[model samples]
Target: MGFGAILDININHISTRLAYWLARNFDEKFDKLNVGKHQIKITSDTVYEVFGIPKGPKKVEIIADKRKVKKQEKI
Candidate 1:
């Protein structure tokens, strides 16, 4: 329905299949797989780890617009 929900669904689907394949075939060759904005790592032969911050969003600062103040006229 929403963008976030759709993105999450796709991520889960792809990651699940990728993890399965990696665990089955290349468990010893590679340690991690970069899928989109996520990093899936193989911790052990049967253990897989997923982190959303490996290449996901970063810290950001929002700046507010400054308004110029008018000078008062001299009396």
Candidate 2:
């Protein structure tokens, strides 16, 4: 395969793993009742932050942010 193809595969693999990790660990943290149209931002190769609506009557007025560590960064 070409370099581009390999890079694409690697990216897909990383994203899939990240999704699974988030679902397993933060499923309840970002439930439908607490979030709407949630957004995830990757802060680094092994860290990511999530933003979403907070649960409550004023969900539309507030946004919740959570940061998670995926793996230790190399020194």
Report the C-alpha lDDT of model 1 over 1-75, residue by residue, as the tens digit.
213333355331234555566566543556766555676665533231233323434655554543432333332
TM-score of each: 0.21, 0.21
Candidate 1 residue runs with Cα over 4 Å from true position? 1-30, 45-75
lDDT of 2 by residue, 1-75 (tens): 113333334331245565566665454443322134665433322121122212344433342443432343332
Candidate 2: Cα lDDT at 70: 38
lDDT of each: 0.45, 0.38
User: Candidate 2: where are CA atoms >4 Å away?
Assistant: 1-14, 27-75
Q: What is the lDDT of residue 54 in candidate 1?
A: 34
Each prediction's RMSD to truth: 20.0, 16.5
